[model samples]
Target: MTVDPSLSEEIIARAQSYPGIRAGIARLKDVLKAPSYQVVPEGEWSTSLSVLQESTVPEWPPEARSVLVLGLHHPKNDPRLDWWDRGNTNGNRRLMEISESLKQWLRKELHLGAYPLPYHVEWGGLFLKDAAVLAGLGIIGKSNLLLHPEWGPQIRLRSILIEGDLQPNEPIEGFFPCETCDVLCHKVCPQNAFSSGAYRRPSCIAQIDSNVANKVPGGEIDENGNSILVIKYCRACELACPAGK
Candidate 1:
C-alpha cells in the first residue's frame, strides 16, 4: 500500500491534542544511527538485563517504521512536575500516562501499533535525546540537554515506536542559544558536571548518589501500606538554563 502523504500531520495532531504536549515524527533507522548511539556501555549490569529482556524487543517489529516523540511543557514554575514521590517523579508518571493514552488513540482510530518505550537506553528503549533531535523537537545544547524552540530546555520527553512510516520532521536549524547566552547552566551545577565544557557523567552521577543517599521528607504510602522516602534528583543545570522561557 502506498504511504499516505498526510498521515504524519494527522498523527502529530492526535499527539498534540493532549494538553501541554507537542509531537514530532522520526524514522526509526535514523534514530538508531544518530550521534551518541554507542555511549550505552556494554557493562555487566546492562548487558545482563538486556539479555534477560531480549524477548521484549522482538527485532523492533518490521511495522515499527517510525517513532512518535512527544514533549511535555514542564514550566519552571511547576515544581510539582519535577518532584519525586517515590521511584517515579510526578512528571515521569504523567508522561507515561500520556504515552498510554496516545497508544490507545492510535490503536483504535488509526489502526496503528504504538509501543511505549522505557526511559533508559539500558532497557529495551531507544536513545530519546537522539530520537528527539531527529524528530525535529530540538537540538542538543552546550548543557547536553534537548533545547526546544519554544520551551527552551524546560521540556520533558517521552516517545512511542509507531508502526506507521510517517514522514519525519526536519531537524531544527538557525536556533542557537548556548552560542551567546551566559553559560550559567554550567555555573549552576552544584556538582560542576559541565565545569570543563563537557558533561562529566561520573560527577553528575555522584551528585545523584548523594541526593539518593540523603532522601528528603517527601514520600507516600507504598502498595503494601508502608511509607517510602522520596529522593529528588538534581536538575540544577536544567533549571538554570534560560533557553525557552
Candidate 2:
C-alpha cells in the first residue's frame, strides 16, 4: 500500500511545531549518546510487523505511514540499564515511557494514531537491533547489539508506529564497529555466550524465548538461569566497547 501523499509534509510540519518532538528526540541522543538517529523505513522489519498485526493488539491503520525509532545509550558505566531485573521491568519501563510519551504527544498535537509496541517476541516485538539498523540509527555488531558510532554497542531502543504516512528516512551507511576494534565483546562474556560463534539467528531467538519462559511474575532470566534477583539486562558486549569512553 502507498503512503498518503500529504502524510509526509503534515508529519514533518507537526514534528517541527512541537518542541517536544524535537526535545524528545534530543533527549534520547543526550541520554544514550547516540551518534545516529532516524525513522525506520516503510516495510522494514516485516516479520515483526506481521506479528503485531496477528497479535491481540488492534490492527495497524491502512495508512500507518511511518515509524519513529529512538535509541538510548546503554553505556558501560551504567551496566544496570542492561541488567535483567526479573521480567526486565527497568529496561522495558524506560522503553515504554519513551514510546508512550512520544505517542501521546503525537496524538494530541498531530491527531496521529500511535502505537507503542511491546519488547518481547511473544508480545510481537521485533528484533530491536534489526529495526535500529534498518532505521539508519546504527549497525549491529558481532556482539549482537546495535552499535552507534558515538555510543558503540551501548544503546537501547523503542519505537512508535503512526497511522498517517510520513516520508521514510534514509538508511545510514556503515559497517560493523568491530571491524577495526579487537573483538573485546566476544572475549568478555562471563558465560562465554559468544565463545564459539554459536548464536545462529534462529537459535538466538529460541534462547530468548526459552529464557523468559516461566519467569517470576515480574522477573527476568538471563542465559545463565539465575532468577528473580535481576530480570533482563545483559551487557558484556556493550561494556567491552572502547568507543564513547
Candidate 3:
C-alpha cells in the first residue's frame, strides 16, 4: 500500500502553523532504535531519573504507525521561553497546548488516535532528540542537543503518535556544522560539562542545582499578581553555539 505524502505534509503544516513550532514524520521503529532511546543512562553522569511503572508509560498504540515530532524554537537568549513559573514555563505551556490542539484535530477531522506523549521519557514519553533526528528535523550536534537547520539546539522537542503508518522523510546527509567550528559550546560551559566528547551531566546538574538554590526573584508574576522567584537554568553552552544565531 502506497502511503500518501500529503497526509504527512498536511499534518506537519498544521503543526508548523503555530508560531515557533516545526513538525516532521519518522517511523516508530526507527525512533525506538535511535541513540538516546537505546541508552539506559546508568553511568556516573546519568541524567535519567527513576523510571515510572509500565502502566504509566505511554506505550505505542497498536494502530499508531507514524511519529510526528514537533520542535518549538526557544531562541537563544529568549528568557521568556525558559522562565519557570509554578510548574511550567511559557514555552512549555504553549507546546503543550499545541499538542492538545493537534490531538483534538486528529480525533475530530481524521477520526484517528493521536497520542501526544509527555516531554520526559521517564514519564511515559519518547526520547524526543532521537525522534526528531529520525523525523528529518536535524542532527544531534557536538553539544548533544538536536541542532536544527534553522533553529539549531535552541528548539524544544515533543512528539505525537499518529494512528496510521505514514511515509517517513529521509535524514539530512553530508551536513556537519559542528565539525568546522572551534566548538565553543564546550568551552563556554561554566561547569565544563562538555569537557570532552562526553558531557559530564553531574557537573551540569550541579550548576542547575545551584541556580535553583539561589532562585532569582521577580521574574514571573504569580496568579495573585505577586512577583515570584524563578530559576534560570544554565544555557551558556546552548547560547554560545553559533547555530541558530
Cα lDDT of candidate 3 equals: 0.80
Candidate 1 residue pairs in backbone clash: 152-244
> Model 2 compared with the native: what TM-score?
0.63
Query: Who is ahead in TM-score, 2 or 3?
Result: 3
Ordered list by lDDT, greatest first? 1, 3, 2
Candidate 2's residue-wise lDDT over 1-245, tens digit each?
Answer: 46554555554444435322211111112222233224332221213434223233445455554566666665555656665453344444566666666677778976878876566533634445655665566666777777776776666776566675454544567555567888887777655667677333443444445444533333446577854464343454567777543
Best TM-score goes to which candidate? 3
lDDT by residue (152-205, candidate 3, tens digit) is 788888788898888888887776889888998988888888776668777887
lDDT of 1 by residue, 1-245 (tens): 46675988998998898888888999998998887785653213222443222224435677888999999888888766876564566787788888889889989998999898876675667888889999999999888999998998888888889995788899999989899888988999998888889888778877887886787756467678877777777878888888874
Off by more than 4 A, model 2: 1-58, 174-176, 195-228
Question: Candidate 1 local accuracy as lDDT?
Answer: 0.81
The TM-scores, one per candidate, come to 0.87, 0.63, 0.89
Worst 10 residues of 3 by lDDT: 45-54
| Candidate with better TM-score, 1 vs 2 | 1
What root-mean-square deviation over C-alphas does model 1 reach? Answer: 3.7
The lDDT leader among the candidates is 1
lDDT for position 112 in model 1:
90
Ranking by TM-score: 3, 1, 2
Pairs that collide in candidate 3 are: none
How well does candidate 3 match the true structure in TM-score terms?
A: 0.89
Cα displacement (Å) at residue 39, model 2: 24
